[model samples]
Target: MEVVRSKEFIADCSWGAKDLASMNGISTRLHWTKEPYKWHVNDGEEVFVVLDGKVEMFYRIGGAETSCILESGDIFYASVGTEHAAHPIGEARILVVEKEGSV
Candidate 1:
């Protein structure tokens, strides 16, 4: 058993993550980032939750690009084949749920 405080979560580097759990081939992770993640498409669906701070989420669909700002407690759902990236407003803690080994 373990307890993680998202507000106190910090990483040694940008976009560092701690694996929280894996169930039914789905992985849950806690991530700390102060920079933007690379644009990529996940092999499956992704559930992105902002636990602390803020984030600017960018996504491309049908070759059209769009973005949205997400505050703490906001959730972003990325379906399969969705290309996306996350840019933190400052230091942010995020929870990501997706298929195992997805990128």
Candidate 2:
């Protein structure tokens, strides 16, 4: 068994993460970031949860761009081939679940 205090978690670099659990080909991770991530489409589906702070999430739909702000406890689900990016309002902690080895 393992315990993680999300608010107290920090990483040496932006988007750095700690593995929390894995089953089959899926993994759960805690990520700390203060910078925006590059827009890209995941090969598989992804589940993103804001654990602390705020994030402005951007995504492309049919060549059009749209975004939304996510606060603590907000969840974002990205299906396969969904182009998306996440920009932290400041320092933020996020919980991510996706296929193992996906980026």
User: Model 1, poorest ten-residue lDDT window?
Assistant: 3-12
Residue-level lDDT of model 2, residues 1-103, one tens digit each, is 8789999999999999999999999999999999999998887999999999999999999999999999999999999999999999999999999999998
Q: Give, for candidate 2, the lowest lDDT window spanning 10 residues.
A: 1-10
Clashes of each: 0, 0
TM-score, cand. 1: 0.97
How many clashing pairs does model 2 include? 0
Q: What is the lDDT of candidate 1?
A: 0.96
TM-score of each: 0.97, 0.98
Clashing residue pairs found in predicted model 1: none
Give the top-scoring candidate (TM-score).
2
lDDT of 1 by residue, 1-103 (tens): 9998878988889889999999999999999999999999999999999999999999998999999999999999999999999999999999999999999
RMSD of 1: 0.6
Using lDDT as the measure, the top candidate is 2
The regions of model 2 sitting more than 4 angstroms off are: none
Please give the RMSD of candidate 2 to the true structure: 0.5
